[model samples]
Target: MELSRRIKSLPRYLFAELDRKKQALRQQGRELIDLSIGDPDLPTPQGIIDKMSEEIRDPRNHRYPDYEGLLEFREAVASWYWRRFGVSLDPSTEVMALIGSKEGIAHLPLAFVDPGDYVFVPDPGYPVYRASTILSGGIPYTLPLREERGFLPDLRDVPSEVAARAKVLFLNYPNNPTGATATREFFREAVAFAREYDLIVCHDAAYSELYFESPPPSFLSVEGAKDVGVEFHSLSKTFRMTGWRIGFVVGNAAVLSGLGRVKTNVDSGVFNAIQRTSIWVLQGNMDGEVEGWRQELRRRRDVMVEGLRSLGFKVEPPKATFYLWLKVPEGYTSRDFAERLLEAGVVVTPGVGFGEWGEGYVRMALTVTEGQLREALRRLREVKL
Candidate 1:
C-alpha cells in the first residue's frame, strides 16, 4: 500500500492543518473569528441564483455539456475580455471554460510540462501553483518575491541554468497572500523575458475585478502576449460565486488547445446551469451587484488595516484583493504568530504556508462581516505584540 512518489512529496495543506487547530480550540468552547481562508462571506447575487434555478428546470440541460463549454458562455467570456481588457479572443479556439480558475491552473502544468522539466513559480505565492507543478511531475523553481521589489520577482535575477530548463512561469497579480498588483511596464518586461527564455507564461488574473485603484493589466493586454501567454479568470472572486465552480482561460491558441486536450480527457465540462449563470455574470448584467460587493470589501479592507495599525502592527492597506499581508511581530515565526492569534480567537493564515520566503509574514483575510472584523480586531488589540 505504497503512495505515489508525487503524492508523498506534497507538504501538508496549510489551511487544512489550520482548520484542525481551529476545531480543537472551538471544541474547548472558544469562539473563533476565522480570517484564514479568503472565501467571501456574502451571498450569491439573486440574479445569478435565479438564472441557475431557471436553467436547472430546463430538461435539455440534464445532458452532459460540451467538453469545451456552452457557446453562449464562451462568447460572453470573449466579450468580457474585449470590453474589460481590450484583449480580443476567438471563442472557437482561444477560450475554454473551467470548473474554476484553480482547476485550470493546476491542470495546465500537466499539459505543457513533461516529467523533470522546470516550472518557475513565485515564492510567497498561492500554494496551488507549486503544488500543481509537483503533481504534474515537474520540478518547481521558486522565484523569491520580496517587499523591496514591490513583491514582484525580477526575471533577470534567475540563473541561466534554471531558465534554460524552465517550461512555464506562473504569475498572479492582485496577488493572494501579498495583495500586490503588477504594472503594465512590469508585464512588458516579463513578456520580453519569456520571449528570450522560450517559456510559456501562465497568468492568474482571478482578482482583476477586485482592484481598488487602477485595473490590473492582463497578460493578453500586452502586445504579442498571446504568442506566449495564457491567462485564467474566475467568477469566484468577482461575482461572489466561489461555490459555482466556473471560470475561463484565454490566450495562446496552442496553449489553450493543450489545456483543452487534458480537460477533454479528465472532465466533461462545467455544469450547464452554472455556465449559463456565468454568461450573465460576464456580460455585465451583474455589474451593479458585483460593484456593491466590491464596495463592501473595500470598506472591510479599510477597517482591517486601521484596526491592525491601532493594535501596533504595521499593516499596509492592500491596493487590491481582500487580504492583508502583515509582518509577524518581532521574535515570532509566522506559524507561531498565527497560532497565538488563533488562541486569541482570531484565525489568520501563516505566511510560511505559502512558501519559505513567506516565513516572516501573516495573511489576514477580510472575508468576514464588519461586525466580526471589529470583534477580531478588538481581541487582537488585547494581545501583546
Candidate 2:
C-alpha cells in the first residue's frame, strides 16, 4: 500500500542515520555517553507514585475519563495557576486535560487550520509544531529565532500577506533546542500580533517549571493574551512524569473548546488514575521536593557548562531548562560536529535536526550524571574537529 500524500510530505527523520551508528557501536561493546534527548533522569517523586497507587485501585477510575478532564483535576490546575503565576483561570470553561502537551499541540492545527492555510511557527522549534501543521495540510511559515535576537522570533519579519492568511502562531519558551526564555513584553507583543492577524496563539510552556533563575512567565499572564491564545503545560518535565502522559491547556475557552472537540473524536482522555495523581501533585505541599530537583539540575548544568567552556566550546549556562546550546567548532557543520562526538562515543543532538536555522549549533542535555558528564568531557577533548 502506498502512503498518503500528507505522510509522504513529512520531513525525513534526520536522526535515523545517527541512531543506526549508535546501534552498531553498541553491538561492538562500545560504551556511549548519550546526551541527546531532554528526558529528566530523576524518578517521579515517591509521593506522586504513592498517590497513583491509591487512585489506580479505585474501581470508578477504570472507566473512561471525562473528555474535558475530571472537574477536580481542572480545579486543582486553576488553583495551581493562581498560586504559581498569579493567573486566574475558570476551571469549568478554560481548562482541559491533555494526554501530554504534545498530543494537544499536534491536534490544535486540525481544529483551526484549513488546507493551504499558514501557521507561523518558530524555526529550531519543537518538531511537533511544523509536523502537525503539515499533517493538517497547513503551510508552516517560519519565524526565524536567531542568536542575535536572544532566540525570540521577530514577529514583524512576517510579510503582511502571510500574516493575513495565518491561522495559528506556535511559541515555546524556555525553548527546546535553544534554552531561551521570553519576557512578558515579548509575550504582550505576540498577543497584539495574534489579534491583528486573527490567529490562535499556541504557547508550549512545558519547560517553564525547569528554570534555574527567575521563574518564566506564562503567555496567559500577559494582559489580553487570553483573548487570543492558549498555553500547553505538562507534568512531564516538572514532576518527572514524562511516562505518565498527563498535561493541560488553559486560556481562551473558545480555542480550548475546539481542541477539546478534536480530542474527544480522536482519542479517549488521560487515565483517571493519572489525572488524580496529577491533582495530588499539584495540590500537595511539594515545593521542597521540586526545589530539590532544581538543585540537582543546577549542579549538573554547572558541570556541563564549565567543562564545555574549558574545552573552548562556545556555550552559555542557560538561565532555564537543562539544555546547553553550543556553537559548533569553526569549519564544521552541526552534523559533522555531532558525528565527531559520536566517534568519541558521545552523543549530542545536531541543531539542524530541529530546523534549517538550527545549523552550526549542537544541543546537549544535562540528563546524565555529573560523573558521566566528566567522562564525556574527557572523550570530547580527544576529538579533532
The reply for model 2, stretches above 4 Å from the true place, is none
lDDT of 1 at 329: 89
Please name the candidate that would achieve the greatest lDDT relative to the true structure: 2
What local lDDT score does residue 202 receive in model 2, on the 0 to 100 scale? 94
| RMSD each, Å | 1.2, 0.8
TM-score of predicted structure 1:
0.98
In candidate 2, what are the lDDT values of residues 126-148, reduced to their tens digit? 99999999999999999999999
What is residue 369's positional error in candidate 2, in angstroms? Answer: 0.7
| Candidate 2 lowest-lDDT run of ten | 279-288
Considering only N, C-alpha and C atoms within 3 Å, which residue pairs clash in candidate 1?
none
Q: Give the TM-scores of the predictions, in the order they appear.
A: 0.98, 0.99
Best-fitting candidate, measured by TM-score?
2
Clashing pairs in 2: none
Query: Tens digit of lDDT per residue, candidate 1, span 1-385?
Result: 9999999998777667667889998999988998887888888999988888998998888889887888888899999999999889999888999999999999999999999999999999988999999999999999999998999998989998889899999999989989999988888888998898899999999998998888888888888789889999999998888998988899999998998899999999998988887887788999999789889989999998888888877877889999999999899999889988987999988999999999999998899999999999899888876
